[model samples]
Target: MFREANSTLVDREWRIAEVCQRLEHDLEVLGVTAIEDRLQDGVPETIYTLRKAGINFWMLTGDKQNTAIQIALSCNFISPEPKGQLLLIDGKTEEEVGRSLERVLLTMRTTASEPKDVAFVIDGWALEIALKHYWKAFTELAILSRTAICCRVTPSQKAQLVQILKSCDYRTLAIGDGGNDVRMIQQADIGVGISGREGLQAARAADYSIGRFRFLRRLILVHGRYSYNRTAFLSQYSFYKSLLICFIQIFFSFISGVSGTSLFNSVSLMAYNVFYTSIPVLVSVLDKDLSEETVMQHPQILFYCQAGRLLNPSTFAGWFGRSLFHAVVVFVISIHAYAFEKSEMEEVGMVALSGCIWLQAFVVTLETNSFTILQHLAIWGNLIAFYVINWIVCAIPSSGMYTIMFRLCGQPSYWLTILLMVAAGMGPILAIKYFRYTYRPSKINTLQQAERLGGPISVSREYRATTTTDRERSCSIINHSTEEQKPSLRTSSFRFS
Candidate 1:
């Protein structure tokens, strides 16, 4: 009875102290409960894949520092090999925290030249101090470390860390499976939520939700990269195709003394987007340019996401130049085939229309590698539809809209001229394609070389070097072309860390 009374008095004193100090709770002796939390399968392999992709992995957990470290080891985030180095920072005072950060910075600077195999484990207090006072130093330390763990961190701290990284120009990706992670998920550039035993609050808040963590490997490396590449290609192709058609019409206007007349009739214009040109791009969207094995073999492709590597100013200019060239070829061929004075205006218009349609078809066909039966049908269907529409419009009485149609669909020479013009216009484009194929450097060869060297870092260096060299070449070309005025192009290199 006396012991119980003493314990009550002590608890009362603790509660009063907590109220006065604004502490979390009073420390009292309580019964311990042991609960087992098993990790999901394939987590280690997933972490390994991310590491190979040059992604920095961090764990912000409410668990104790030791528990977090043990889980990190089991997940292969903390390597078991002797080559790994663990840097611990758990200081209670500002001076202690400063000293710990200084030590980490010193170690990082000393080993900056080598491939680092370091992990950092810091408690909440130390993290707060480092972030508040020595943020730049902390950022450098985190960038150098292979993995980082912040135990006893609140959800707010996780979000703050993500924001800090984003401010530093890092494309942060936050993945979590608990309600406590919702803020972090929202804070990051890409939020991936794991639908695990914790709950679905994080999943609801995330941009993408996955059943297992291992799936993130495929999600980011395969699907993400594919989406970016495919979108870039499609966007460039769409602009090029449209610009080519527009330039052709502009050329026709010049020949016609700036008449500003429409080249194709309403029906053909409608069919171009809805039927003739949509299938190849749709198919290309689903097309996998590189196989899974290729991606896994050369993880450097993942780095392309950092900048506009796939689609940039140089590529856009190339597409524009090609579009202009192709437009001129088509126009010159059609005009030469049917002389401006010899042929009627309607005849010239029909030839121009047919050439434009066929050019679009050729462009679509060239964009794809292999054609499926459905794509083949779409292409043929567009041609058949155009001819059938022309026949119907011709069969109708010569009216307000059918006057041009009546003139164009008259003789077999009209059809023959179109076919000849299409064949003629394809020559330069085909030659250019062959030239590109013959001289273009093979990416597969570079990947094979990197594999033979047995170092992914070498591949990364080679890619950066190639990018730098290309930028220098482009700058030199600009300088030579415009000697009087100099153009400044920003050449910022990507940092994987």
Candidate 2:
């Protein structure tokens, strides 16, 4: 934020600022209107979406201070339209270097037709300027951070601001496309490199890469919040389903061993694990978010770890029902098989068991997430891989220990259904605790109108449409090149992702 202060310069700095201001004034008087238009189109749909989603944007630049302020206002990057904004910082000394180079090049111009000769003279002048007067230009920058929207900053100052923002625990993102910005980009939490034609170091350090700022809205505003809810939902269902499947497997194991009846054949066990157990878990975690207020949590899971004080009778009965059901089925089946003659096992039993497990898994998938069964791609893929491995392991002729653990082939009889009891007992308990997320109302209203300007959106070539009066227009200065200025401590303007 620049204030007209008592001169501390050798009297030349103020002269330079005044001359530059005069040049811009003359350009406007000559009808060379500065370009400023609304950067964010003011359609209600945009406003609604932005507000509903809750994300903020700030526009920082190395352009003239007034111009940056004007652009910020025009784009509504700072605030809602029509409210005046603050002018925090203005740094445009880099333009002076180009002017100096221009003069030097013109002096050497003699219709040199040969590009190499022209380039040689240009390089000489640039090198000479760099060798002298770099610091003289930088000391003029003022850091008015408390109320200022912008600051005339140098590379060191830019890096210092990064440190300051970091101290506040803000998840800072810096995006840029130039060499001068690499320092700030590296220091940020997420650095996105745009216009990589300039370089790749910045991009290499970034968490995500994208082509433009327009794509950033979905990531920051919408998907960010959405991912949070999705993850919580997935967590509940996957854990619930896992517990249920374990009980079913245990039940069939006892039926085989005790009742002299087969439970799951090797293939069936593999199918249950591959198709039924892991799919929901994989899908639930695919989209992850860590937003604080709009988290999806299940009520059963939320209070389970609390204590007996909150324990309800219904909760314990849930397990009782499942256990009783499994016990009764096992008792009837084993008694009948033991009392009567045993029969040869049919492939249908194995098929039915596998099918039942798959169905159970599918139903559980429906509990918490909006995703249809097919979208659980990672879960399904991993299941297939695990199934192949399980089959290979189980088909081994002498692996009695492995067969016992996972419920492999055995006699099909009801007396051996103790394993089934274990499975039925666990399923529902897991379901209530982990399979459903209690949805929460979003705290998106807490999001504020963004930007340091505090009022009009600032952007280049976009604020012109918003300015009606001369003062608003004057806040945006259009340079017509009077005094040549060079960026003393070349700092880059960056896009923070």
lDDT of 1: 0.66
RMSD of each: 11.7, 18.8
lDDT string, candidate 2, 382-457, tens digits? 5455445555655676643244323433545332443453355346655654433224311111111112224532
Q: How many Å off is the CA of 476 in candidate 2?
A: 23
Which candidate number maximizes lDDT?
A: 1
How many steric overlaps are in each model, in order?
A: 0, 48
Best by TM-score: 1
For model 1, name the residue pairs that clash. Answer: none
Model 2 residue 489 CA deviation in Å: 28
